[model samples]
Target: MGRIGVVTFPGSLDDRDAARAVRLAGGEPVRLWHGDDDLAGVDAVVLPGGFSYGDYLRAGAISRFAPLMGSVIDGARAGLPVLGICNGFQILCEAHLLAGAMVKNTDLTFLCRDQRLRVENTNTAWTCAFSPGAEITVPLKNQDGQFIADEATLDELEAEGRVVFRYLGNPNGSRHDIAGITNARGNVVGLMPHPEHAVEDGFGPGTDGLGLFTSALSGLLETA
Candidate 1:
């Protein structure tokens, strides 16, 4: 089984859930620390949601410079799969591993609910198990959950089919309803929804979120 690492920033709140999700998906879960530079030889890494640094300099702004992120950025660029959920998505953007930025919601209120999302692209490492056009429900929560980018960037993302997930109801006023996106290599991905929060049935929306972890394992096997 593949070993997946879940990084824990000081204020991270969902690292354990992400690790458990990885384990449930039949992969070994490795815990990584923000202050460490080593990746612990994990096949993939997950940046789970939380208010890192208490959202002081923006949701993910400060956490972007954590010691571990340097290795993460380099690893991701070298074809290591990286999945960022909610605040983790924000940090990816802040680190320039992913494009765009996340800002306050349109309503200026923290949102918490089960959200419906459509899989727009399934070629990504984190989304390969999902069929294109498949609709899945996952829990989403955050104050700065709105995804924004320049028009050219948005157009490029659309043109390249990098927009991996789209909101069914356009919840946070993100451009083109983008809930998730993949890098050009299709290895690194970031999304505003909290997939880790919905991995177990009867505890979350459903098992829709499990596909993300399962997909990672499948991708590793295919590449191996």
Candidate 2:
């Protein structure tokens, strides 16, 4: 089975849920420490959400330099699968594995809602289980979930079909309604929603988030 590593930062709120989701999707969940420098041979990595370092300099500014993140950066660039949720997404950008930065919500307040999103692209390892154009509901909660990019990066991302998911209701005021995005090669994905929190049937936003884990696993198998 694929070994999926879930990193836990000091204030990480969703690492357990992310591990459970990986187990439910039939993958091994390996717990990784933010201070540790190794990934323990995991096939994929997931950076779970929370106010890492209490969101000091920026949401992800501090966590971006965690010891394990260096290995993650190398692995992701080598085409290993990686997924970032909420604050994790912020970290990916801070780490430069993904483009752009997250800003405060357009309303200038933390927002929480059962957000609807469209899977605009399913070619990424993290979203391959979902169908293109599929509509799914997941919970969104954060103070700085807005995504912004320079015009040129935005155009390049659009032209390359790297925009993987878009919000249906335009929550958080993300450009092009983008809720999630993938790297050019589709091995790394970062998004502003909490898919791990929505994986369980009654405990979450329903099982809508399971597809993310499952889809990623399936995509890996299909290619191998």
Candidate 3:
């Protein structure tokens, strides 16, 4: 089975959930600590959602400098598959792994719901199992979820087909209704939705999020 690393930062709330998702997807989950510099030689890594460092300064602002993040950034640059959710998404932006930044919801409040999203690109390592333009439901809960980027960057992402997921109803005022994005190499992805929470049936929105974890495992097998 593919071994996936799940990094746990101080105040992280979803690392276990992410690990469970990996296990449910038929992969082994490796636990990684924020202060550790090693990645445990896992095939991929996940930065789960939470109020890392208490969301001080800014969401993910503090966690971005954690020792583990240094390795994550480097590994991601070298083609490692990385999935960041919610606060983890903010961390990816803070670390410059992906473009765009997240701000508070347009309504200036924490919102929680089963969100509908359309998969825009399936070329990424974490999304290869999804069909093009597929719509899926996942749990989304966050205080700062609106995604913002300059027009040029937005256009570039669109032109390159890097926008991974788009919200159906534009829940948080994100530009272009963007719910997720991937790096230029399509190995690293960051999204505001909590896909881990939806990976198990009889728990969340549905099992719609399992494809992401399974996709990564499939990609590893193909390249192995």
lDDT of model 1 at residue 109? 93
TM-score, every prediction = 0.98, 0.97, 0.99
Which digits, one per residue and each the tens of the lDDT, describe model 2 over residues 4-96?
A: 999999789999989999999988899999999999998889999999999999999999999999999999989999999999999999999
Model 1 residue 31 lDDT score? 94
Once superposed on the true structure, which residue ranges of model 3 sit more than 4 Å away at CA?
none
Task: Sort the candidates on lDDT, descending order.
Answer: 3, 1, 2
Better of 2 and 3 by lDDT: 3
Whole-model lDDT, candidate 1? 0.93
Q: Which parts of model 1 are misplaced by more than 4 Å?
A: none
Local accuracy by lDDT, each model: 0.93, 0.90, 0.96
Relative to the unseen true structure, what is the C-alpha lDDT of residue 27 in candidate 2, on a scale of 0 to 100? 86
Estimate, for each residue in 1-224, the C-alpha lDDT of model 3 and write its tens digit. 89999999999999999999999999999999999999989999999999999999999999999999999999999999999999999999999999999999999999999999999999999999999999999999998999999999999999999999999999889999999999999999999999999987799989999999999999999999
Q: After superposition, how far is residue 129 of candidate 3 from its true place, in Å?
A: 0.3
TM-score winner between 2 and 3, please give it.
3
Instruction: Give the C-alpha miss distance for residue 186 in model 3, angstroms.
Output: 0.2
Q: Using TM-score, give the best candidate's number.
A: 3
